[model samples]
Target: MADKKPDSPSHEPPRGPILVPVDFSAHSEAALLLASDFADGLGCKLAVLHVVHDPQNMPGYYARMAGKKTLTRMADIAGEMLDEFMAKVQKRHPERHALHKAEVLLVKGIPVTRILQVVEKEKASMVVMGSKGATGLRHLLLGSVAEQVLGLAKLPVTIVKEQPKY
Candidate 1:
């Protein structure tokens, strides 16, 4: 049922996978690790999703060289990054079986919109994501994804900060 994805529309709400949206930041890493524990404790699957967002001013994984610009396939780049990130997370916490068995999903769109959409489409039981805890003018202008998701998401959303390991 974990890999069945959107096809399983009739899936029970409480039995759906725990969705973890990762931005490859330290906070997101923490969220993934924590989500693994949640999944294990609940006996639910973990679905790790990465959104390939490209702003108007600068695209995702864009490189400018000698007045020439090159754009890598955002999906491709995001896929590789997501794979590497999952690997790193699993390596760091080898005991997290849920992390090792997480279902990987890649989608392209605005982070907040895509995330909420994924929640509905995948029928996620809950969302565990990281927040940078942005404040001041930056937060005013570019609100954190967590804040937007919190406001918009219909399901439970857990925002986690980076935890330092001793």
Candidate 2:
């Protein structure tokens, strides 16, 4: 049997799936592409995660848009969006089978906190996310999810910028 790494006692190349958090942005699609490549190269599973976070000003956006008066059904709406997003990903890259069957996970919380929670819960080998980069006042106020994840994640974290040509 092959020996396991000091951090991973499973004797597998990766102890857990590669957790990828997407906000349904162009950069996220790019991150998914690159994460798929990493998963393929490492022979590990992929867990596509979408966190349903409502901004302070727009709470329950999904529930409201879905014609519900409450936030209770937001998870259902988010699931639908995740489904549509995955379908689009499959359509966009018909050749990438890794993206086709990735495990989908959806949760409701703040993006950064939820992301870190997932890494520990899933025991993710790494995290790959996209960054548009926050600038000026936005940087000081909201900061960037990638930067926060990079600073906090104990495991490897890869931040990919959107590459239109890629």
Candidate 3:
């Protein structure tokens, strides 16, 4: 009779898509580059997510008059902004196509909550985001969206620390 041997761990590599949340900031650009590197190394896809929070919920007089006209104007502005951002990124990183195709998604809601929603919808294996570092009393008082998302999301999160000098 032959003795049974323990099974060895499979050598299969981790495979899945990577999602990057962008706010069209320099920090976001850094995070996108990081995500691109990871995606290229892992042979995964990269998706860019931008959340356009509903202005109605924002604390201000704008919330009081969130009528059709106001909403339309806001949507138009958001669309233009997103378009410009995508164009700039595309222009800046022409070599990005070699790594992986990009996706631009525009959603509305609380930034962190919307991000989590997209993560679930996309079935992303991991998320990359930029941390706009807040210091001292500001950090303590307002808190950070990156930190909030880091604590809340179920999947792994890669936080790209912004340059402290900037």
User: Each prediction's Cα lDDT score?
Assistant: 0.84, 0.86, 0.76
RMSD, every candidate, angstroms: 7.3, 3.9, 5.1
* Candidate 1 local lDDT, 1-166, one digit each (tens): 3576676566343688899999888999989988899999888999999987875724434232212423555576668778888888888888999999999999988888999889988899999999889899988998888989999988899999999779
- Candidate 3: segments with Cα more than 4 A from true spot: 1-14, 56-72, 98-100, 163-166
Give a tens-digit lDDT track for model 3, residues 1-166. 9665568565554465788988778888788888888887777788888877765644442333345456555545566666777788778888776223777788877889999999889888899999878789978986787898899999899999765573
lDDT of 2 by residue, 10-82 (tens): 6558869999999777899889999998888888889999998875735645654577535446777788878
Clashing pairs in 2: none
**Candidate 2: regions farther than 4 A off:** 1-12, 57-72
The worst-scoring run of ten residues by lDDT in candidate 3 lies at 57-66
Ranking by TM-score: 2, 1, 3
Each candidate structure's TM-score, on Cα atoms with residue i matched to residue i, is 0.83, 0.83, 0.76
